[model samples]
Target: MSRRSLLGLGELALLPGGAAAPLNAGPLNGALSDDGDLARIGHRWRALATRPGTAAVRAIAPTATSLWPDLPYPSYTETPARLLAMARTGDPALADPVARGIEHYVRHVYTPGASADGNWWNWRIGIPRRLLEAALLIGPSRADRPLVEAVDHFVHPCHLAAYEGHSTAANRVDLCQVMLLRAVVGADPARAALAASALTPVFPYVSEGDGLYRDGTFIQHSTVPYQGGYGRVLLSGLATLFAVLRGTRWATSDQRVFDLVEKSFAPFMHDGFCMDLVSGRGIGRHPYGDRRRGREVAQAVLLLGESASPAERTRWRGLVRGWGFADLAPEAETVEPAEGHRLMAMSARAVHRRREWVAGLSMASYRIAHYEHGNGENLRGWHTGAGMLYWWARGHREQYSDHFWQSVDPYRLPGTTVSTLRLPDGAGAAWGGECPPARWVGGATDGHFACVGQHLYGLGSTLEAFKSWFFLDDAVLCLGAGIRCADGVPVETIVDNRRTDAALTLGGGWAHLAGHGGYVVDGPLRTLREERGTVRRAYTTLWLDHGTDPDAASYRYLLLPGASPELTRARAADPGWVDVLANTDRGQGVSVASAGLTAVNFWQPGTVGPLTASAPCAVLVRERGDGTATLTVADPRRDLDGLTVTWDRPVAAVVRGHPLLTRARTGRRLTLRWGRLADRGGSSKTVVVRLQSAK
Candidate 1:
């Protein structure tokens, strides 16, 4: 079949079985358009066309004869494919180069034995998809037989089917794309149905294992939470499939896919900044990994927005504007208040956002690794997932940007409790080293308020601590307990490790690190600066020196992001804003009475305020002040089959928006039981129940 004829077979045609019908090329014709994107495509084509082809390949990849050795060689195919797409839009300037580039790619790059087996997957799927896209755009003739045969040889149906039950989300998405594209170009109805059916396992959501968790965490390469790089690739591929299948026989009716774009994915984005936790070490290794100008979220919004409904388009456009893509929609304003908190149960990470500040707390459970090691970066980041918090507020979006790789002490990440034991240069570099299983590794939140805790085990040392953070409206209350290390090294908890040339101020039980924020320590505080080459960073840290006593030590402080010296002192003196309900090795609790909220991390059954639980759990209780109260409960360790809570008030309760089946009132106490924590599944394993005071 000729390329034009293959693409023209857009009308739905039935197969022998009741399989999905094949779609025409109409959706691929005029549906995707972006002027800036087109201009960039044209520029890439012109750059390749002007260069001496052999000389360009040699200069780009002098080490080997294979085209894949050259990083830009893949783009050599992708650029022409995109240009050919532009040619159909009546751009006559790109016609000649698009044709010439294809011939060059087939002759030099696509030759047999030129591709390395190591990247066989990319050559088989990634390269062929682009070539096929270009051939379909430019009408195929009898002369194009070699190109079609080359693509068919590399991306055969059997090879694509082998990856049907792959563990990684990105791999599955890529394989599906190749299958769908090959089915379209080859005019094979059975392959198209196979591709459509294969998507059933991955589409909408994958809550259990290696795909996208319902909590919005995307696990790739099996264990890495890859919401930035690999996750974006999955999202882009899915968006492309959605666009191509729109109004087709294989169209999806699931709204959860759309919900992923809005709810799960969008929360990780702030302005144009993506938290480095999701980006992994790309922020330090890649040239474009600078956190200041992240385009992952923006690109996804643009591509996905193209296929979204009018309402979703407006919402995505607003997001694009907020990401500083103002040229796309000049009138759209940034989303305001950006206020909410989400604890991704699967990854054991919490994201808290206020109007003036945004904080991400990285924690790890036995189910997830404390930190990733491949790529030569973050080799010493053993403590990143052990209660390491990254804070971004006004004027400090790029605080740790650029200098995080080797400039700062990896052990002194802000909001982390670390023993001063120097890591042996490449310690813990191996992939997939999870922390020891411990209770209180997760947190609880009710949208605006959050309480996260961790029973931390220091990497490569005998150090243990209980770290907790209470994310309130204006300030974050940090608490630590059970900090005991027998290594004789001092234990320190970093309040803020920021990159700035600003001077440090110490007075009135408060220490201001820079204009970004300050710390109100409950005890003696220490301030220091470390110099790397010509760069210097100031840190406001608290110290715990335990010689050999196994006695549990504790510390408390308030992190005031975007606060001035005056405000820091005022908050340090004001005890009314925060109240420590319980602080011990067994359990930790806090109540922000002004917010009418009490949060407890119970290592065992304990009491905080008028609420008590019968087992180890994390609970967040909010008195809504309107005869109603909201309670969020979770078993962070994921061990409890069930737990019960008794509140000293007569009330009727509803769990997850449904009235509980078994609830009783005895005297003035209301009792509720949440059962089958493991059966509920997902990382959260938590339930939100609303209680109304009985009349």
Candidate 2:
């Protein structure tokens, strides 16, 4: 745990012959601490390093090359990893098994013309990567030539300047890793240089398509927000490359990667768990839950700190410490106590982090997919992006893990208003095909607070609604209007579908789930409890039935995260915490008089409370109650030349203005105008104003 030991851990992390840590470990297991806990790392390595039992290794059919012919793709790659682990641990007793494993890989398993049968990834990167690493680890063994040549047959595509269409985002980085290892194993500096050069395209931010955007959105397959799935792979690969290639001719020079630790990834990580909303189809993968993904990210960040600048390294170390030590001790201070709120407009995602809890909102525009189902995963994620909200409170970071994905009804994910129409397995479309054709999917945020909305378009159904979420300090106020669908199925707004065994209590138009939080509803709230799936885990679901084929039906609710049952009842009884100033097709607005905060989603030229917007826009105002206020506005539709707002309150002066604010008038009615926003990609602008006191 000393500074010297921490530095030593980084130095030895990527040395040849070191056992590679498994990327996806079990939930809440394998957290790498800031002090560089070597025993934990060694324990994980030994878990992966422990070779198959004598009988299991002997079960390799004598004539067959594959260790497991019936499961050739992934099972074949495990041999070299075991061999490398044995070699690194210096186990003379297991030397023979390592040699036999290497022989099997070179002679039979990975022999020339080994059927390229399964997923292309297995043949190209998976198999060759392990073998190449084993070669580097064992240090120029006599079997290097045949090993390189055998891997060459399958990995020739990686050596190419371009990996065809497979060279983008995570796939590109994975392939580059293979190329680098192949070069080191083959003793070809030229190949290593090629690998380093091939990585150039992966560093810079992209305007669109499969890459990291400027606004911290990590997209893959050109649509799915994969900050937790493929994005993790990209970061881990980069960290390995940075470590293994350090000081070599093939070393990477792009420093932008260090910046991504905080900008592109940290927001999705809350209390040691990656938010599942952005993980796409990977959420359905067994044993790779949000906590495991978060641990993987933490590991990568720790490794990345070795090459990061001092400021970035300090920040990353604090983050890794926070994630690793979260919930370990309730009394201990965390690295980020008050993360505030963020709206990643490019990814159509928002997160609000409070001291006691964190909430994430996932929405998809035409630019992003609603959900992705491919390779037989996430088949029932039809409503993941329908304004789904995922939150975590203290001591409940494990809520989304432990068979939650398998047992909970996918149709009733919390924070989503979905139709009761039963969807077929793998419903809608795969890849990027599930995106709704709506551009008004982003929001306006002042960093500390935000107003996000989605102009809902049904997926493979006739459902449409306008949904919005106002994130405040105490609660998230949700409003939905213009709900219309004609598919002969009931439309329901799921207040929550919690995975818990605790008692669910309902009283006075409010519901509370023990150990979770509370919901204040504006309609008759329906509740149910059922044991689901093989785990027999219990779930409590709360929703409002909008009935079948209704028009213009609306819903309003307040989600008070971490609120006690008594507090929830009191808030429900008072109903003055927030006022729904308007809820209609043209506009929806809410006001918190105590906070002096008001937000509105203007669907058209309409008036809401004391504010009128002349175009479709999202607006938020924070009044100081001392004759001063700050206004934030955004054109989420991305088709406005200009937007004008007239407020009933008179303005004394424009204290400050944003770059997009073209005009501001101080008169009986304050007027503000903004222009040239069509190309701004739905980013928000803010201006401060001084309001004249009413005599």
Candidate 3:
């Protein structure tokens, strides 16, 4: 019943190899007074490190190759480095298993081939390529040349230059590993090229400042019943990338990364809470992840040890513990034994001599960061930012900040821990986190979200917390569906208090969202009278309340991306598609023509379910020449936003505009290239050209 958590280290001692340490604390920053409660934390870390366990850590060690999870598979080969860490700690009792796990990680997670790969895997490119941090954690002494080669191979080609010669979600993971790879390997030619080339995508192509990140959102075209939340890959990826660049010795290598981290770091934390910039908002206090806070402490401790400013490390410590306030309740929280060892392994830089500061910093940081009220975005993440957040959490607080807090055994679920939502209509659907399944309907991109993938991700998807994202053009809207204001309440109208009816709060009733953004929709747009919670407007545009963060206060509306509208008319189009566009202004020509225009929202303030699709989303009746039946879509972003008219066969609609995001052409009978995002603040015109489709 110790308030302090523990990892089930039973698997550590049973390794097949020789002696190994139960844990390696990693680097520490001595940013604290020589004596005090912090010193006590240091002692605790020491005692925890010595605590017996890791039976399996030894069995998995020794193999030259990295390991991958058998069932769920692994996201990276960090598990191997994690194992070597056990051996380095000199735990004596856990060497064997630790070594074996290391072997398995390299062999399974890193190999690139159909045989070793998971059904849906980025591992071949993810594990080894990104294992540099893991290798560093294990120390250069333990990282064999093969491991290094694996790391290099994975990142250089797969991660850095995979999609369209730019960074995609997968690329982000690649880049994430690059930090550690570069860290352990030093600045070689390959490393420099990787860094420079990857650098372009990081900025302007990706983040907030310039393009460090892709400034937008997207929804995968599936058929389940979900849309991407505030971010893709959960928003955690973005933050993690920041932590890695800043934590490892690489902090000085790239000023852009450093600056991005510093600038975005504040919003990512937020008074301790780590919510998705989009949704996943939590109230109350905050909490920290075991790994992330630990990493911050490690870095802070290292800085302190190296004679860095004491204030900076101490400040980071406070922020570290503050992370654990409200979101996340990983299965590990319920486990016993090795959890303690895992925690120590993640935080204690024991071999580094003066790591006492690490213990204190980690504890304080975890306490604050972990408990912060949030749905998950910052925890597991909920946007294109997932790679960044993951890198941060896994690199630093695998035990707390990221999915490790939620994962029972890091080695158990591995890659499976991360998943995407079902296509709103049940097409090719998959999801993560916990919850009850929701309904599906015909909308813009695909169908809709499971309405449950959010909860499974621990971000309360019912509230529209977790989601995946992908981008083709600069314009994207990978975002979340809104949740209600009354915290702890569901968005179902049937459940009343638990439900946030669209008609209840009006346009952001609980959100304090206000903007003058206008959009252009072909033909006469229907206008809905505004009420308390919901508003009957032509197209549902996104509004940001800023959640009390003045810095993050920003607004954007969806717009025409790439769908070519073939036909059009008042309030609804004939048989066409609605293309989404993007802009940062707050003014444009807007309308709600049918045949392809929809709006989906994450963290939508008020709602009810199965929401009456009667208002926001309407079924437009349409037909094909041969007598096939299909539905025209309008505003697919909204849970009930799309207005569709079905046809018997295929239809060709050219949706043109500035703010388009993605194209979704999935359906048994009809294909759709719906808007990824539309209605940005700008004046625009629409040209509709109708055509028939091929079955």
Q: TM-scores for all candidates?
A: 0.80, 0.89, 0.34
RMSD of each: 7.5, 6.4, 21.9
All candidates in order of lDDT, best leading: 2, 1, 3
- Provide the lDDT at 403 for model 1: 57
Clashes of each: 1, 0, 285
TM-score of candidate 1 against the unseen true structure: 0.80
Cα lDDT tens digits for candidate 3, 1-695: 01121221212213332112324443211321332222222222222233234324434423333343342345433453455345435354454344335445556555433244442234333444334433333333333455555554544555555434235433443454454345334424344334435544443332111122311221111111000121223123333333223322233233333332223232233223232222222211133333333233223222221122345433433433443422222221221111110011111000000111011011101101111122222333222111111112111222223322232221111111112221122111123222123211112221211110111121223222222121111112222222222223222100001011132112211111112111222222222222122222122222233232122112222221221221112112322222322111111111123322223222222222111122332222223244332332333222332222222333355333223423333233333333422232111112222445444
Please write out the lDDT profile of model 1 over residues 238-269, one tens digit for every residue: 76565455444565434656677766667777
Against the correct fold, how does model 2 do in TM-score?
0.89
Clashes of 1: 1
In model 3, the number of clashes is 285
Of models 1 and 3, which has the larger TM-score? 1
Off by over 4 Å in 2: 1-6, 9-65, 68-96, 157-164, 326-334, 625-627
Worst 10 residues of 2 by lDDT: 26-35
In order, the Cα lDDT scores of the candidates are: 0.63, 0.76, 0.27
Candidate 1, superposed: residue stretches over 4 Å from native: 1-116, 119-121, 124-126, 129-154, 159-167, 183-193, 249-253, 287-294, 331-334, 424-435, 486-489, 533-551, 648-661, 681-695
